[model samples]
Target chain A: MRFDLIDHAMAVTGAIIRVLVYSILTLPAILVVMSSFTNGETMSFPPTGFSLRWYRAAFENDLFMTALWTSTYLAVLVAIIALAIGFSAAFAINRFSFRGKAFLQGLAFSPLIVPAVVLGIGLLQLFAWLDLTQTIYPLLLGHLVLAIPYVVRTILASLTLHDQQLEQAAMNLRATPLRVIRRITLPLILPGLLSAAIFAFVTSFGNVTVSAFLTYGGRVTLPVQIFAYLDTSSDPLVAAVSSLMIVVTMVVILAIERLIGTERLA
Target chain B: MLAPMIILLTGFLVVPVLGLLRSSFLSGNHLLEGSGFSLEQYFHFFSDSYYTSVLVETFFDGLVVSLICVVIGFPTGYSLARLPPLARRWRMIIVIMPLTLSLVVVVFGWLIILGRNGLLNSLFVSLGIFASPKILLFSRPAVLIVLVQQFLPFMILSVMSVVTQIDPVLEQAAANLRANRFATFRKVIIPLAVPGILVGFNLVFVLSVSAFITPRLIGGSRVAMLGSLIYERIMAELNWPSGAAMAFVLFVSGLGFTAALNALAASRFIVRGRRHAL
Candidate 1:
């Protein structure tokens, strides 16, 4: 009887703690959505009234839209470049046994440890000194550097899970290395590649620390623009922009959940 | 295969970082001049009491926030680990949603949630707890709250991954030995979960100390962590050397903390392994 009572108490404790913490973590995004619809001049919680004024404000604002476009294209370009390079590196490390393989692996993953602030400043100076800051190449390259490690890691994970004999069997049948890769290796890791694309896209799109210094001329990424905007205004339009991002993230996360189990993501 | 990655990472990431290091030690205010070396920048940085205080405060803030994450996240992660796959999937979404949001957007969401006239104040007003919206933004508590919201995902995910790897049969054995739920949790679960807790703790701590955006956006002018201070040096003062020094200090401190933590976690792991072997 006492044991059952103790179990009941623990259960009750777990239920209450779980509910409280999850709400605190999740409800703030809901509040952002609600407040973005406010009719008032300034933001208020529970919102004063419902209107899409801020949505209109966000749409009408040129800075937000341009930055959004810049960020989108930058992310797309980064996904392509990082995917191409990262895939080859991952394939090499996974399939081949060679000297310096561990060193190569460590080098590929080293950026995960370096502070983004450091990377931002380093790239900023590198570009400015080389007179490359005037173009978007710095931004492209910086995001590429940041995004590739993730791509390599994800593709390697898929490679690790795949059985080796299928590729060997294809090779034994007198298939060329390129043919084996095109027919067997590429088809097997498509899901991993897709996830890597998503990973690269999101990292590049959302990056600020690196882009903060590398944003050349009038071209700013959305995150950098939003951070600057928040410094000057406390208006609900920022909330509207944020809400849209929240919605997009929700959708991407859901799509990923469907394609690959959430277990593979973290 | 390795040629592309090697060339890209070396030419960009590695070379630039070397440039940054060289820039920090330059005699003049030149960016990465290969001509000369000096320590005046480091001297100027550590000589000032204000800069020293910022470094200290950044460490303190990281320690406190990291502790809170472990406390809150361990329990929460364990709960998620206990859930069935279907239930866990939905819960994982709720957890990862905040993580997936852009840093700026995440900070913006919290800007209102903890704003003066925002959610907390609104709740208080409706419940007659406060007469009107109170000032909560740009304060220490506000900064702490936002930092937690931003990085708690790291903690929860780390702990979850480790916790899930532990065998459920061990807990079953504990229960069968007449240990109650609380006793089993204390003896079997906590020991096994230590690795996750340490992993989560290191990630949250390392990321917390190096994070610049959360401090800049939410903490604002009132709070001066190393990240924001480094930003001021580079952006506002245009003093590259000083900023580089501060960034290194931040990076080194993170390295030291993690190294110490690894030693602690590894020692425990070795002892545990030996016991199992015996």
Candidate 2:
């Protein structure tokens, strides 16, 4: 009877703690969502009242809109470029037995672990030294490096899970290597590729540290813009923009969850 | 096929990082001529109390966060890993959502909650716990809380991966031996789960040390970290050389710590394997 009571008490305590921690994890986002509808300028808890004024203000502001367009285009471009290369690398790694293969894998994945600050500044100095235009190309290149690792990781997992006998049979049928890739391999991993593209797109879109050093000449990414905005303004406008981002993130994560199992993401 | 990948990595990734290395060794502040090779910039970081302290703070912050991550995340991950298949999938989605979202976007949530007239402060006032709303923003502890929230998923996933691989029979056997839940967890579960715990520790440590946004937004000027310090040097002072040096310091140290932990994990695995053989 005593052991049962203690066991029940401990279980209840654990449940309470877990619930508390999960609340801490999820509540701030809920607070932001609720606060964005504030009718007043002051950002107060429980909000000052309900209104869409800040959402209106966010769209009205040129900085936010311009940055929004900039981020969208860059992210789309980054997704396309990173996916193309990462797909090729994943294909090579999965199919081939070659020297320096481990080296290549390390090179591809290094950017994922390396601090973005170092990579960002390095790319900046490289571009400045080369005297190339710093606005678009360098930005693409910097984000490309950061996005490639996730692309490779996801595509590789897909490739490994897939039965290679299909590809082998295609090859035995004397299908051209390129045609085999086009016909057999590509279709099999297309969903994974899409997920990888989504991963790359989000990574590039959300990037700020690299964008910080790289952005100038009226082409700041949305994150960089939001960061700068917070320096001068603390109104409901920031909340409004943040809420929109939350909605978009929610949508994307759901879409991704449907497209590929959430396990691929982790 | 390999040509494009190689070109992308070598041209855009490898060469540029090499450029950063060269710049870090340069004598001058700005990325200009008279860039004689010098270690003065490295010395500058070590010489100043301000710079060294930030370095200390960065590592200490990482240590505390990693330890907290392991302590908090282990049980959560164990629970998730032990769940039924359907519940596991649903729980994973919630765990992954925060990781998928922008750090900047998520930090915005923290910004609102930790603001002067924010949720916790209001709760305190409403409950009559305090006479007034407390200023919780722009402090290290404030940032630390958010950091744990942000990086907690990585730790959880790390633990889950290993815990899932661990055979439940081992626990059953321990129970059959009349060991209680606590004893089974301490004797069997923890020993088996050390690899995962170490992986989670290494990951959380690397990430927290390298993180820029949480400290910037949540802690702000009040908490000086290596990331923010490097940002200020590069952006405000336009000191690429100094910034590059600091950045390298962070990178190399993070890598070193990772290597050390890997070695530790490997040695333990070997020792355990030998013991099992006996």
Residue-level lDDT tens digits of model 1 in A47-163: 888899899999999999999899889999998989999999999999899999999999998887788888898888888888888789899999999998889999999999987
Return the top candidate by lDDT: 1
Which stretches of model 1 miss by more than 4 angstroms? Answer: A1-10, B27-35, B276-278
lDDT of 2 by residue, B200-274 (tens): 888788888978867877887889889888888887899888888999999898889888877987898768756
Question: Scored by CA lDDT, what does every candidate get?
Answer: 0.84, 0.82
Query: Which residue pairs clash in candidate 1?
Result: none
**Which 10-residue window in model 1 chain B sums to the lowest lDDT?**
B26-35
Give the per-residue lDDT digits (tens) of candidate 2, residues A23-89: 7677767878899999987888879878899999999999898888888899999999999999988
Worst 10 residues of 2 chain B by lDDT: B27-36
Highest DockQ scorer: 1
Give the TM-score, chain B only, in order for the candidates.
0.92, 0.94
DockQ, per model, reads 0.65, 0.55
lDDT of 1 by residue, B1-278 (tens): 88999999998899988888878886555345556678988888789999888888887888888888987887789888878998999889888877777888878778887788777888898999998778777787778778887788888888888888989998888788788888877777877788788877777777778777888878888878888888777887887887887787788878887888789878987687567536
